[model samples]
Target: MSLFASFEKLLSSILLPIAEKIDKQVHLSAVKKGMVVLTPILLLGSMAYPLKALKNVFSDSAAVQEWFINNTYLIDLLIKFSLGFIAIYTVIAIAYFLSEGYKIYTVGAIALSLFSYLILTTSVNPDGSLDIRFFDSKGLFTAIFVAIASVEIYRFFTERKLVIRMPEGVPDFVSSSFELITPTAFIAVLFISIRYFVADFTGGLLVPEILMEVLAPVVGSLDNLWVVWFVIMLRLLFWFFGIHSAVLSPILSPIFVQYLSENIAAKTLAEELPHFVTGGTFSAFVNFTGSGVTLGLVIAMMIAKTQRYRKVGQVSLVPSLFGINEPVLFGAPIILNPILFIPFVLGGSLIGIFPLVLMKYGFLAKPFFDPPYLPLFFEGYLTAFDWKTPFVQLVQIMASFCVYYPFFRIMDKQEMIREAEVQAEKEKKSVFSKKDDELLDELGLDF
Candidate 1:
């Protein structure tokens, strides 16, 4: 029992610091900006005649397909469906620039994308006016194919460090098979096959379905304790995707709205006492929580013990409350600290729970206010119910900070150890350099 207790403490200590650093360093803002701008291009490119058949591609839903068999619209839709791949490629190329930097594979990317676009466009109508019945597997294939291309493009530039490692004895071909190139090729081949068979090329087959499915279970089980796990998973995912609140907001808002809302789908929301006044089924609850822009990173700053990190924690506190953690993440350099693991996670957990607690207590009527990243102090109070939500929000923020405080101190100590190591290395180097300097004095090499 004692051993376990000690182990638990040690683990928490290590994790607390690690978590804190991660909270600070995560970056998704740039990705969100790129995605937002890319949406229109993706929509337009997915059509046979981007300008004319664009509307047709969108309208070719199951209802349209059932109603308009053998129609001209279908043909156009297929053309556009494949063409959507070009749009995805273009968007990805642009978004890559927005999110990260440059890629070495531009020559191949440009060549393949242009060819795919030409095939997709010319298939339905050379003049760019096609129909909606074109919604076939090719469309799906094109979209995925393009998306894969763009994602790979975006990831290459945006990747901080290569996290993937080649296994010790794995064959090169087998190892490289799972890499982005092979799977993307497979998707393209599969999509082309589907397009040829179905005639309607714009397919919505796999990736979207996968994305939806992944979100479904987590969104569906709003009341489960596992929801916390869902939230944590989301945070981790955002980290992987480049930590942008904008990207996370759209994904998370619906779930949070569902959590605080009684009315779902066609059903009315369950009635509850008005907390702040807006009361019942607000999306704000989710938004504010994800705005993890606040002192969540400050907690990491606190856990950081080095003089540099301490200055970071102390300095970033004010801005952090306004929901901006980037300053601290970059400034403190806490992207991968192990000790701050505790507070970093708990902070988000508490932020999510803060409104939940209020919603439950009838202190707030409903979580109606959408979470925002700026103006940190007023962040929580923006929720629909009780004024205490703000106070509670404040408390939650403090709790995040507090959780990281001791652990940060421990990490600060660790930073000192690191600095010491650096200094020691420098000193050893200096000794060798000193001898060289002395020899230079005799040799007259000194300037």
Candidate 2:
């Protein structure tokens, strides 16, 4: 009859089951875990530029400037090897994980996937070396698709016992080397055929470019506020169901990074902000404190009457402040909690909308610099290279708090009631056990 009860029924009947299904789906599970495995390195890569950005703050100081100038090589090194090769890592990770799920040999699968990915992305420089552009974010979608497809092919051949098998006397290392030959050759040929022989759908565009074109309408529409909201909303929705949002990152990150790149280019040319929505916009602004903007929710919980809320809030608060929310999401158990469904998602979606409105009215500037590792509001300010953006972030935090507050209170009350019931049941059990103990003592005397 109550709102919480209705929520419980709905979640049990629909949301929880669907979430379980998603978590169990092989490909989706692979994508989620694979991307998660890559998050740390990607996060480190994202942080690489912040050192340079911090150095810029002291540009007027000769000693500080000299130190940064001397260390520019290090900054470049971090960004280049890490973020620069992100697509390569993504493909290898996806292939490795998918192969793991299919019970295929991981190392060979990764090698095959990497080889096939390179085949599809083969581009030559004027100096005859391989062009590295597609090895980065530009080739992300290609990398993901190729990784998945290549692994499937590997699984197909290996599962059917199509590969040459070594006799019992051979070493595993030597045996695997021979076993890898057939599947690797097949994977190589498959991609090679698609690369060279497949008919061009969009006037000689390669697979990645063609895929980009197919996704163009959606990517192009990101400039619209509604589309941005929808994308962010969908991400939050998945997170609520315990799905790792990074599964969609390869698809969305390229678009976000492209828009951010355009913003950087425009700034270099002294032009206007090319687009309002960007990767930096989401990373530095919308997801200021991780998915669901749960820093605000963490704060709300910190003030709650429920003991569980307060404890989890304390544990999650500091991390959420820095844009990580897993401690609370899993600890407070946000997933499948009906009381949190509205706030966890809708609150996060709200964070994305505020920036668009601010940009429309000239209250905030579009982000230009791509600084990372900086904390929430600071990250926003650095990205925009404008002080006002931090102020906007503060306002957004307050707005998020307002959005999460009501639902949080309801959840807090539910927790308190549950705790009370649990305590009463424990006391009742203890009383009955004590009475039984007394009766047992009297019977022991007769015995």
Best by lDDT: 2
380-441, model 1: which lDDT tens digit per residue?
45444246656666666566556656766776777799999999999999999899889989
> lDDT (0-100) at residue 97 of candidate 2?
84
In Å, residue 19's CA in model 1 sits off its true spot by 21
Query: What is the alpha-carbon lDDT for the whole of candidate 2?
Result: 0.76
lDDT of 2 by residue, 1-447 (tens): 988777657655775566567667787677666665665665555555456677768878999888887888887777667666777887888888898888878898899889998888867879998877776666777787888888888888878989999999999888888988998888777787887764454465677777777877877888877888888888787777777766566456556655654565455446988678766667777787878777778888899998888999999988887888899889877887777888777777877578766775677887655555577677778666677887788887888788888888888888899999999999999999888888989888433
User: What clash count goes with each model?
Assistant: 75, 0
Report, for every candidate in turn, its global Cα lDDT versus the true structure: 0.45, 0.76
Return the clash pairs for model 2, or none: none
Candidate 1 TM-score, true structure as reference: 0.42
After superposition, candidate 1 runs with Cα above 4 Å error: 1-220, 223-229, 237-305, 330-336, 371-373, 427-447
Q: Candidate 2 at 171: error in angstroms? A: 0.6
